[model samples]
Target: MLSEESSTSKENIGLTSSETSTKPRSNLMASVELTGFADNGAGTISATLGNKANKDIAKTVITQERTTDGVWTCKIDGSQAAKYKEKFNPTGCVKK
Candidate 1:
């Protein structure tokens, strides 16, 4: 037979240990998004990996010109194009 005080102390210790063992852990993921535009006609955006992990990715410039009736041509920097392609699809670009 156990005393009342001893039983209470044991229950408290068990509760504390159970709470500590059941503590939740954090899981993180990587993501990217386009935020907005910049001063020099460029797109501003952000990229994040985990909690408190963020970065100002880049500002891409968008250019458009009227080519024909109801038609327009758009262009982007070659370097920027390559970077985006590589980011989305690592397996080289194919031309048909």
Candidate 2:
């Protein structure tokens, strides 16, 4: 199991410049391969508790795949992806 709240560093994707600690953290659930991603497999999930004030939690089923050229791609919720595409870059995520 992964920690919901792990020590973060500046290199971490969501961390800001003020942060300086360093440690590799798993952003996605376990992958079938060494790449830390899964395309269409069972037992893959990621949960996030957003914000400090409100207890808003989101449990997402991670879906990842590699292109023919070997580039990593993923899928988020279709509607959310459409709205947040510019910022979130939900590439290769198609409506299901």
Candidate 3:
């Protein structure tokens, strides 16, 4: 049984491991690759992003969107600074 917190978190994020099928959009021009993950899954990707000085300072579930072109784009949530973080900045999320 999922706890209330877990259930609410899932609802708020709106993503599950099983929902990995994605279709490319007509507008995207670039064609990259996720390397190991499903090539077509373009949606929310939740991951724990941390800071250098203090890991917990910016530690949060940073969600990136794998666009139709296969690039992981950052989606900012609240004031969490998920977009400005090092790993997600400049290059975007790499499935490591």
Candidate achieving the largest TM-score: 3
RMSD of each: 21.7, 10.2, 13.9
TM-score of each: 0.22, 0.26, 0.29
lDDT of 2 by residue, 9-84 (tens): 1122432222332222333321211223234332222222222312221222234555545665564442422123
- Superposed Cα deviation of residue 54, candidate 3 (Å): 2.3
Tell me the tens digit of each residue's lDDT in model 1 across 1-96. Answer: 111232322222231123324221222213323322223324322222233322221222333333324344444322432133324322332211
lDDT of 1: 0.28
Best by lDDT: 3
* Ten residues in sequence with the least summed lDDT for candidate 2: 49-58
Q: Between 1 and 3, whose TM-score is larger?
A: 3
Q: What clash count goes with each model?
A: 0, 0, 0
lDDT of 3 by residue, 21-93 (tens): 2221211211111222334545554544342324332434445576767776664332444334444343543
Candidate 1's TM-score: 0.22
Error of 1 at 80 (Å): 6.1
Q: Give the clashing pairs for model 3.
A: none
Question: Which parts of model 2 have CA positions greater than 4 angstroms off?
Answer: 1-57, 77-92
